[model samples]
Target: MSEVPEAEVVFVVADLAGYTALTEAHGSKQAASVVTRYVELAQEALEPGTRLVERAGDELLIVADDAARALRVAARLRDAVEREPLFPTVRVGIHAGRALEQDGRYFGTPLNVAARVAAHARGGQILCTEEVRRLAGEPDDVEYRPVGPVRFKNVTDPIVIVEVVAGRRAGEPTAVDPVCRMLVRPETAPARLPFAGRTYHFCSFECARAFAERPEAYAEA
Candidate 1:
């Protein structure tokens, strides 16, 4: 092991949302391709002050010298993944605090918070802790909305989470999954069904099945 030095940095954790479902539905080869493309796109989106710290299967940990810069990078990553046809949606969680860095890896409470926050987010959403929201201040065209406080396992204090909204780019057609509320691109949706003269797009077959079982329940909702 190497020496651990404390550093103040912005941590961002991102992963493909619905990754497990994608693997089970599409098999290992397609899942592996998704991971590979994710890494490529993420690396290309990196700015000067930010660096990719680690990649574990479908998840990525990135560190940035500044909170605002990290938020920009995160948003860019989200957009990149969204525009890619047939790729699963990406979810991101960000936080800023002191963490021990050793041999190009990071460890500490802040990192854990970021990971937990990421897990809380649905696909296509960007979430950040209050610390990050405060540090990043108010960037132009970006808004942070509070999602409420959440307690994480092994974390002593409850973290106030916020959704980082940059707004969706115009002209991209997307629909909401009635069951999970995940945003699905109509062109890439794996499952779609027609009901009541309107078509519903789903991110997965399971959601489609649920909708089929009770069309009125979701159609009205």
Candidate 2:
């Protein structure tokens, strides 16, 4: 029997947020279908230097050439499902590192980092390693914010995360929340406010009103 060819490929990992609760509520069979669809969508959309490597119920493994495209595709998938509201929110993690493959399958530290990064992602968000950011180039289509360094099991070094903006694709600013003091997703957020001659996104109408009611309460430097 011939062994599968050994080669290296870039790896990506992703997962649905709060899936455990869904699994408990939906049962194994129904949950299986939901996860299956997730992988199917990702598999159908992957571009060059990409392929579906594994789909174990709720987790997805994909190989890609650049991390930016990985992040872009995942964001698009989440945005697509979010528009329906019936679908659950999703999170994505991308890493651009070489992986060792056996029989056309890939594995190694790069794959593990991708999984850990995915675990840290928030709803409709994508997390990327520094290496990935460098390889993927600057992503102007999306805005990014630092999530600080996180510790993951089996990882000796702390991994820094960046949030891939999924709220509005617009290059224009939306609204900023004085309370939260960060740009919120316009669609999910209810209010838009002006600060420093630019609009900022808020998560809800209540936040918008709150900021308007007391501008000094949450003043920034």
Candidate 3:
């Protein structure tokens, strides 16, 4: 048997946040519509060097030639999903490493790490390991916020994670859900609460309740 070739690539795992609630709030048929639309947008967001490896349920696995390309695709997908009315926000995780390539599918620790990284992200957020951040360097339009170290299931050693932000500016007419970290339009958010003399917006009542329970934890500085 021939050995599978190893290639260095960037992996991105993205999924819709609040998908279950979206299903429960809107019914299964409508939920399916959102997923279908999201898949379409995901396909459209792919650039020349990027590939949509596969999609399962609300999550997508995307491979890019480099970390910068991965970030661009992730940001584009997130923005596209959010632009649709009533669509669930997208969260993404990215990592750059070597993976075994065979049968048009990749397999290895990089994939596992990327999936775990994505799992730790909140809606409207993009997280990547330190490897990806170093490879991606620094982009003018993107800001990297350090999330410190995180431990993932079935993975050895802790990986440093950082949040990537490319959409919206400081003065944009948008609010970030304190609990879920979802980016929402202030006018359209389903819930809002006053804390520390400031108003916070949320995509749903669940997140609002969570913030209410622990305002000190999720409150912005």
Q: Candidate 3 versus the native: TM-score?
A: 0.79
**Displacement of the residue 170 alpha carbon in candidate 1, Å:** 3.5
The candidate with the higher TM-score, 1 or 3, is 1
Q: What digit string (tens of lDDT, one per residue) describes model 3 on residues 40-69?
A: 999998998899988888889999997888
Steric collisions counted per model: 0, 8, 0
Which candidate wins on TM-score? 1
- What lDDT does candidate 3 reach at residue 179? 68
Q: lDDT by residue for model 1 over 28-113, one digit each (tens)? A: 89789889999999998899999998999999999999999999999989988877766677899998899998768888889988
What's the best-to-worst order under TM-score?
1, 3, 2
Global lDDT of each model?
0.86, 0.65, 0.84
- Lowest summed lDDT window (length 10), candidate 2: 167-176
Top candidate when judged by lDDT against the true structure: 1
Better of 1 and 2 by lDDT: 1
How far out, in Å, is residue 86 in model 3? 0.4
- What global local distance difference test value does model 2 have? 0.65
Return the clash pairs for model 1, or none: none
